[model samples]
Target: MDIKKHKIINRYYHKNCISCKSWLPATEESFYSVKKNKDGLHSYCKACVLKKAKESMLKNYDKQLERMRERNLLPGMKKAKKKYNSSLKKKKTQQIWQEKNKLKLKNYRLQRDAHKKHNITDVQWQKCKDYFNNKCAYCGLKIEDHKILFKGTYIQ
Candidate 1:
């Protein structure tokens, strides 16, 4: 290989790491990038550079965490917060509407309870209704003919 193509290896040969004092091969892989340095290679070896970087990160861990917390409240992160707040507002509005419509809500609860007290779903209830041709299961009366009483309002 041409020595010019391997500038660091040719120039430094086998240099000792400043921090670890261990001999490392003079190559791009063994050194950190330093743009301003004459050979564009850091004085410290890659292992020392990484060790110092990790130590600095650990020392300022709390500051990093606080910065991340502040970042989460920034405009870029507002979409998820806005969605959560809007969903909560919608839930409150729905509750208020249900409270105002007592008769309608009562009918809704009766229909829900008709299938079973536990482990029942709207799909299963619809299946049951379809099986009986939308008629009362016990009385055999058409849903429009009979009024089933549950919570004051007669539910069809």
Candidate 2:
């Protein structure tokens, strides 16, 4: 008796959508899963499925609204809408306030940062400057001379 061996070839599975007739890989990335199908994937690709769903929703828009009304969800939806509008108004008011006080806010932030970095109050810094007669302690340079050299209005 003589025996013969057959070679096996590797092939990737692909399927075509019944509606669009476009070939796509038979995987979740390209197709939706259908448990009843032999390939375990939907007949239509993801894009076709989404398009069909959107069309169906638009076609049944009135029916969907009626269903939502029946379920007593309109009141909750209205409350959510009111809350969203109120939040938007609050944000707009805050933006207006910030725009009106830009210089004041900038000065407050500078003072806060200076206090944090130097651990000194504005009053203490003023008293120290007065003690030195607003001049450099080591070089005895006047505050105006130092300001010209450093290009700063005040020294820390």
Candidate 3:
């Protein structure tokens, strides 16, 4: 708004904005800058120029979308959705960090499952169960005898 602050970035006598063309004489007070163009001069108020730029940018939405598609992504397919369906997504995504150890989820469960099929006699299981569950020394949860190392009696 100060009359003296309006110095042209480029030495082109910036008058008023072309859109509004607010004839801001060099001596008048204004905040808008005078942008020089190849055509000679660009008229239009600074406010209009900014508004036009925003509109121009908004119009490029489809162009931006196309650019994204050109870079490995298929048209209309969102990268977020693609990641969500991928195996890597589960581990690599922010939703749930994949274990640094990797595809080793449930390894212990699988081992225990296999062991259940091949080892442990009923009596041995009872003994083990009885031993493991003498009750948490402090919590006092009755330990129901569960299977120990599976392996029916063989060579002693």
Candidate 4:
């Protein structure tokens, strides 16, 4: 073996993380072992790997969401939504989000179903329309002004 390669291998083989510059015990939890590598261990420790993964996820959050949405639209994906909804992770996330925006969601539903929901009377709904001069309550932007009403709009 070359002198430099031997030194480099020796440095990381003893449970040393190249990225963190710290020494930890050689264990499956602390280091990632690769069969192809001469030392059979990754240069960076598990903590560094996790930190990198989290950073990458945050940086590509929107792109990742778009990709997942596209993937769900592929063939044989009709049951994907049902499966996702049934998952405990999805249920827990939905519960957390709903809990955080209880008042906002309630107001939204009232405005949305003014004719159906008893909490929002027709008279009160009309008054609100009059108050806003028939403009969108949330955006206040005139619908007539925007020719494309439904296009390029996010519900919530």
Candidate closest to the true structure, highest TM-score: 2
Of the two candidates 2 and 3, the one with more favorable TM-score, higher being better, is: 2
Q: Estimate TM-scores for all models.
A: 0.38, 0.40, 0.26, 0.38
Candidate 3, residue 27: lDDT: 32
lDDT of each residue in 1-156, candidate 2, tens digit only: 111111222575567777788766667998889899766778788888877865665566567557765654444467666676688777798568778999988999899988886577999989998999987776565677545443454456
Can you give the lDDT of residue 62 in candidate 2? 66
Task: State the lDDT of candidate 4 residue by residue for 1-156, as single tens digits.
Answer: 233223333555346677887766565677898887666777678879867765665566566556756668433467887777778565598788779999998998888988675687788878877888876665454445222333334322
Question: Candidate 4 versus the native: TM-score?
Answer: 0.38
Backbone collisions counted per model: 0, 0, 14, 0
lDDT of 3 by residue, 1-156 (tens): 323323354564435454664655443243343456432333455456556765654456466446655564443457655755685655656335435534554676677888888677988866765775654333232333111111121122
Question: lDDT winner among the candidates?
Answer: 2
Off by over 4 Å in 1: 1-12, 72-156
lDDT of 1 by residue, 43-144 (tens): 799878866765664566567546755656433557767776688777798678877999999998899889665776889888989999996676454564
Clashing pairs in 1: none
- For model 2, which pairs clash? none
Candidate 4 global CA lDDT score: 0.64
RMSD of each: 25.9, 27.1, 27.6, 17.4
Regions of model 2 farther than 4 Å from truth: 1-10, 72-156
